[model samples]
Target: MNARLPERQASRALLIGSSRFSHEGLHDLPATVNNVRALADALTDPALGGLDPSGCRVLTDPTTPQQVGDAIDGVVNEALDTLLVYYSGHGMLNQRGELFLAVETTDPDPRRVHYFGVPMGWLRSALADSPARNRILILDCCFSGHATQAMSGTAPAVSGNLDIHGTYTLASAPAHETAVAPVGAQFTAFTGELLRTLRQGVPDGGELLTLGDIYPALTRALLASGMPRPQRLGTGMADHIALARNRAYRPATPSTVKPRTVSEPRGTTITPGVRSTNEQDPKVAAEFHAAMLDGYRRAKKELNYNAGNFIQMVQQVGGLEAARRLLRASSVSSGFTTLWEKGRLDLAVEAVVLQDRFAGLFSDEELDIARDRLAEYGYSPAQTS
Candidate 1:
């Protein structure tokens, strides 16, 4: 059994939205504005009392680059437990592979325009200097991948760096792709789906769900909704960071967490040597057991049943236990039983079948034990004919 770890403290988030323009004349920034509002709503929503929005803050306006920089610096300097940075606007890249966030003052002039967006290198520095255990950087603007590329290329390798222990960065599109916002949508498809998943809650093994479990679900949902695959820019550390930071952000009604099952076809017969298990679906499980029994019958009739094939089917359906019984009953080398036990169920089944076929082995006592086990597991061992 796995031991439980100590619970970490809650996280803090910093949201920056730049919709108004100071120089490049308002670029019709509805998406960014809406994203800011939506996030604010979710945090302040009484339903999210667990999140504790009092510590969170949002900054958006026609500010100078210095003001934007100061806001980021102030938040990181506080050294909060978890720091989440969300930016919704434009992103650009220079010939040097450097990335920038386009702020209000960013010049549109192709030759002389200066990009005011946040530099990923600078962001990494802030995270590295902060005391926060986990850091999440989410960019919803165009050219999101560029930031990831910049960080991966230039960020320091120190363990305490925000880019190390608990750092996660998610981009909406590939490095060169454009991020499109559907009409009437509050945010881009990726962001929308992410919020929806978080709001609905992530699914875990049973009723308990965590942020780690939600990432894959969100990825699938985004793909199903026609959004491009969001790039995962970190390692296991990224998952740890997101989970530790988002623990305070839980959903009210968690999604279902049922395990998957395989089924069998209809009209199959079973035999005494046939074995099955409760691990799989009833019908499919029965079908697999029936196939194993049929194989033995065929070998008895034609004197040429492929033991290898029978073992394979059993392994695919039941597991090592079933395969061992088959091998022992077939009078195959019992010496291989220990080896098969150590192998994967499928592999063990294959080994048993191969041994049975080449050695022409039979274990009557073992077969009888298998048949009894099948009956105990609720499988029918009698053939219809």
Candidate 2:
């Protein structure tokens, strides 16, 4: 099922790419250009959406705060039908827990983020005020997940303090994590999968690349590759919603195989560049688990306690099953980071691979829960806060 987008309607996208920074300490991102080209090309391809060049705004290496605002305003003004905001740059989380997008002139110091970074709240507010109902934000930067949280409508907004809805914030990483641009890949890991999806189309022969159709494949690719997982909220579309058409797709016979379930456990892989730091050290592993247990006990907050992916794994896949899944991934731990970093593929997998042992850390009881509060964190609050 797909969300019914306005047929034969015009679509507009604001593509912002910040590859270089004025500060010497900040790393330059050469792959952002590749992301912009790939996204614009995919959106513009005749076989896909065929959006006219006039409708899309492409901004590169914008430095001023007003420049970012103006570009977003342009998209909001054009949001009569479909609109997408794609930003590839630095994403910072300040001491106040607010998120800012780093511009070309952004200061390297975290304390000075307010002066140099573009307020993420501005985009949220712009999208909320826009007449358009279908809005999508593809944030490919560090702490980009912060966009999932609704920005406080105040002058300097913090996420999750407000209640804004209807925008799909597809973030490249969880809070506090950095999105990686692989050494050999032409694009960032997050955008590379998106490009591949556009090129290959869904396993199903549907020409339209709906969010639902692409999500599983994306998760599989990123999780298998051990990169920061991209997250999405089913905003504006209760079902699959068309973003672009699959250029390479054609009609085909219906298959017997079913699509992967969202609740199903995903395979884990050791991510590239993850150091072996303390991975094999028993004392370090013990200390990490101890801290986790202590924190959960102290908080007495189920939200915080179960917020751990490991616990979520247990809940979704059952204690034994989750452990088995983790164990399978651990044998090939070269791709995963150390356990101290909250990596799933840990050396301790062997010891906790049983339900009885794992349950000691987390309960086996079923949860009939509400996603309302969690839904508020549409941006990716789990990453930083």
Return the top candidate by lDDT. 2
lDDT by residue (tens digit), candidate 1, 1-385:
1111112235556677777666644365666777776776665454533234654678776366677678778778664566777787766665454556767777644333345545666676776677776666788766777656655554232223233665667777777776657867677677777676656654321122233344555556776777765654553334433221233333334363222221221332223233323223455445445544654455435543234434554556553346554434312222122222223222223322322221112233344334333332234333221
Off by over 4 Å in 1: 1-10, 22-26, 43-50, 108-115, 154-163, 203-211, 241-385
What's the CA error at residue 376 for candidate 1, in Å? 31
lDDT of each: 0.51, 0.59
**Model 1 TM-score, 2 decimals:** 0.57
Question: Tens digits of per-residue lDDT for model 2 on 26-84?
Answer: 88898988889788887777666656777777888887878989888877876676678
For every model shown, what is its TM-score relative to the native structure? 0.57, 0.63
How does residue 275 of candidate 2 score in lDDT? 23
Model 1 clash pairs are 101-117, 263-284, 264-284, 307-353, 308-353, 329-363, 330-361, 330-362, 331-362, 331-363
